[model samples]
Target chain A: MNPLWDREILMLLGGVVGLLALGTTVGLVLDRRVTSDAGRAVVVNLKARVRSWWVMTAAFAAALATGGVGSVILFGLLSFIALREFITLTPTRRADHRTLFWAFFVFVPIQYILVYREWYGLFAIFIPVYAFLFVPVRSALAGDTEDFLARTAKIQWGLMIAVYCVSHAPALLMLQIPGYDGEGAKLLLYLVIVVQLSDVLQYVFGKTLGRRRILPKVSPNKTWEGTLGGIGTATLIGALLWWATPFSPWAAAAIALLINLAGFAGGVCLSAIKRDLGVKDFGTLIEGHGGVLDRIDSLCFAAPLFFHVVRYFYT
Target chain B: MSLETLAAGALTALTRLVTGVRARWPDEAPSTSPRVYFANHSSHLDTLVIWASLPATLRARTRPVAASDYWDRPGLRRWLALRVLRALPVDRSDGCGKREALRRLIEALDQGDSLILFPEGTRGDGAAIGELRSGLYHVARERPEAALVPVFLENLSRILPKGEFLPVPLIGRVTFGAPIRLGTDETRQAFLQRARAALIDLRNR
Candidate 1:
């Protein structure tokens, strides 16, 4: 755990670099080929997204290099920022101020600290059971009953999505799978790679072959054709990367497919929230990809289920 | 970078991290000319956010007019305000003469550095902005050539509110509106109203 520079880690980083090179090549080709205004805009955004991917990949690689401690801190910051973005969109009043303070300063840190300490019993139910009850009662004490139900629910939901679900990705470090040494980091890496790859494929397939919308009301860019193509490619790739995880090839495919579907649902649900808020993106952090929340919406949606799946079967 | 710039850079980073700021400039863009960037104040963070939100080049030239009572204390707070932030402290307490405060602000503008002012004089209750004091009008009137830019800061009060030590990270939007000038015959009431309206107009945009 102190120094983890294994061949498997190197291979994963190398594969990511290879993908970056390929992505750059495709970007160059798109730049020369696309003539229409819409095509040029898409290409520009694609290039920006790719550029952001390089930064994100580099950050992720650095985090993985530090082993479990690094990954936990990384995801903890993500939860902090993601929760901020979520709460920023929701309406809260003066009574919610101290409540929000406790949410950020107290609850968020304690939740991640439990993960860092490898307390599985507390990590699993801390947010859902304890914080769930604590938040409303805390707000109720403030005595501002105006929108009490809505305010409490919004804070709870913010903690659930931003803190609970997202933290599960890092909590992968705590999984004690039988016959699988200390390669839980690899599993986290695999899950991230699969989800991200699926997202890219879905976008690629949607832009090229997409015609029928999956649910135009929920998400316009998403389509039946793109979803299938993304799942297909991602599952195939996930199966190939089974050596990195503690799963069989076919099992990897099933898990990748499961993550992709869950990620897709997550993306759609987040998009609905964005529409309700009447904004196109969550924040202007990433050049063209939007905020950290926007980039990890799929991961947040998929992490809990994926963690539980691997924990239940492999561990 | 020197120690000051390095500390300022760190401060700016922390401010941006806490306030997910999205800065929008006027179509005419901010000029290097001596100008007063005024806004509605709510939290202590208002000065930091406005200062941090400026473009890098302009940031060096713009000094926020902070309340001397809060920023001019001993040790770290004063060091941060005077050295790192380069704030122009105007004694906000009642005992300190307004004439002395006005003299220092005018002196700053005369030295060719732009100033950020909260003409409301003090922080409000986070409602609609209270009446703007005549400090800004006097500045505008005194330096007739200087542009008066109305800057609107939203959600900053929520990010770091009154009496709160730890700041909750919240997205704050800064809208810098067009530059206004003091009309030749304009009264103080009319001038402040026009400037206030311009700043509030930024909220919708």
Candidate 2:
């Protein structure tokens, strides 16, 4: 069999199978204890998640069938919608409008095109180097002299939110983890699955045993009990999935904890952004879920950190 | 559905629940022709307050001419304005005279519709009323038969500033001034400044 298929594949499949088993068993047992309000919320969230799961699962299956280019295109669409939501909330001035147009129209497309072509070197520098210079020139052409620094910073931020942070998902195809020959796609799947799992677990744990509010002002939903419990559970699952990844079981567990922690921080920080923008949720892009930003805000934070860690060791 | 009274009722309800709603109107009788109710710009909520403050019968005959570019965007804004509110549109970027858009307004007025105008042109920090743009004067001159009602929108700037997207829940008042008739030889600039003064006068009162 393929070297990448040795144990990590089994680990992932096994871990998911095991978690589903545990989740269903525990969910049924705990049904009696949950309050009506909390139970109702869980049902609604679970249903939405189930819907998203089927959709993502279908995409995952499609990625496996179609290979890198197809998967990259899927992620590019996600980034576009997420970026649109980000810019919609953060106000841009008339001066930066042209810069924003390029960011949206030109830079994002070019970045994804680089991924499609698998030009890793150019893909890496496209946003940071080329788009960086181009945006400023566009802003300068507007000739509106007020708030120059703020205006420039806003354009930079728009790029960061819309393009750079989102580009990490597609960047996964560039990875060459030894022992995982064709498993880069699986790694991407693992990353998304783990990060989203951590998020969902935290919410579930927090609602159940959570007492003291962690940060009521920013996101009233977070709680210390939930954080500790969710991280613990996710780490355990991560360790179990070590069979599917290039890492050892312990290393997998450790990475899971890091991703979980980072994902939580991402959610909280984005919540603060929403609060600043005076919106309850980002744009109403998703039906039950708030927006594209709301869905991937955690991914934006977790992706870079996860990529760096995997690259540092596994490579 | 009288847009203003409906708006006023909603504004009143929202203010009562959060901060509180207050209003003022022109002391004189309603004009037969179209009048531009010009006031200070402050919050997104400013338009709602002015629209809601009109009398029911008069509200039916009035339209708040909003920017076509902004309100025309898909989503909640378009839904509320086009479907529920029925606001008119004026193109801010058009180089040609606003006569085309104003003609639409004239049609509304000719059909016995009045209108609300933001003389400050756009939203701003409500520290003091900003300089009046000449568009209001043009509109007023075109419909000389329409009485010019100066309205002062108070405390709205603080409640929702220009850069801020969200309204800080706070008490705001909309004050309407007495109707001012345009003179046969009144300079557009003179009439515009005097109309702006009426809004400024209500800030303290």
Best by TM-score: 1
Off by over 4 Å in 1: A1-9, B1-10, B72-79, B82-86, B91-96
lDDT of 2 by residue, A1-315 (tens): 112333554456555556556655555655556668967677666556555645655665565446677777777877776666666556555556556656766777888888777677898778888877787778788797677777677667767765777777767767887766677777776888788788778878997799999889898888999988887887787777776678888899889888888888889998988887888887554555777788787888888788879878888
DockQ of each: 0.69, 0.04
For residues B85-109, could you state the per-residue lDDT of candidate 2 as single tens digits?
6688788775774668777877777
**In model 2, what lDDT does residue A132 have?**
77
Candidate lDDT values, in order: 0.88, 0.72
Docking class of 2: incorrect
Compared with the true structure, what per-residue lDDT tens digits does model 1 show for residues B11-91? 988888778787889656767788899998988889888889888888888898888777889999999989988888887
DockQ of 2: 0.04
| Residue lDDT tens for model 1, A11-40 | 987998899889989999989999999989
Clash number for every model?
0, 10
Q: How does each model score on TM-score?
A: 0.93, 0.59
Q: Evaluated with DockQ, which candidate comes out highest?
A: 1
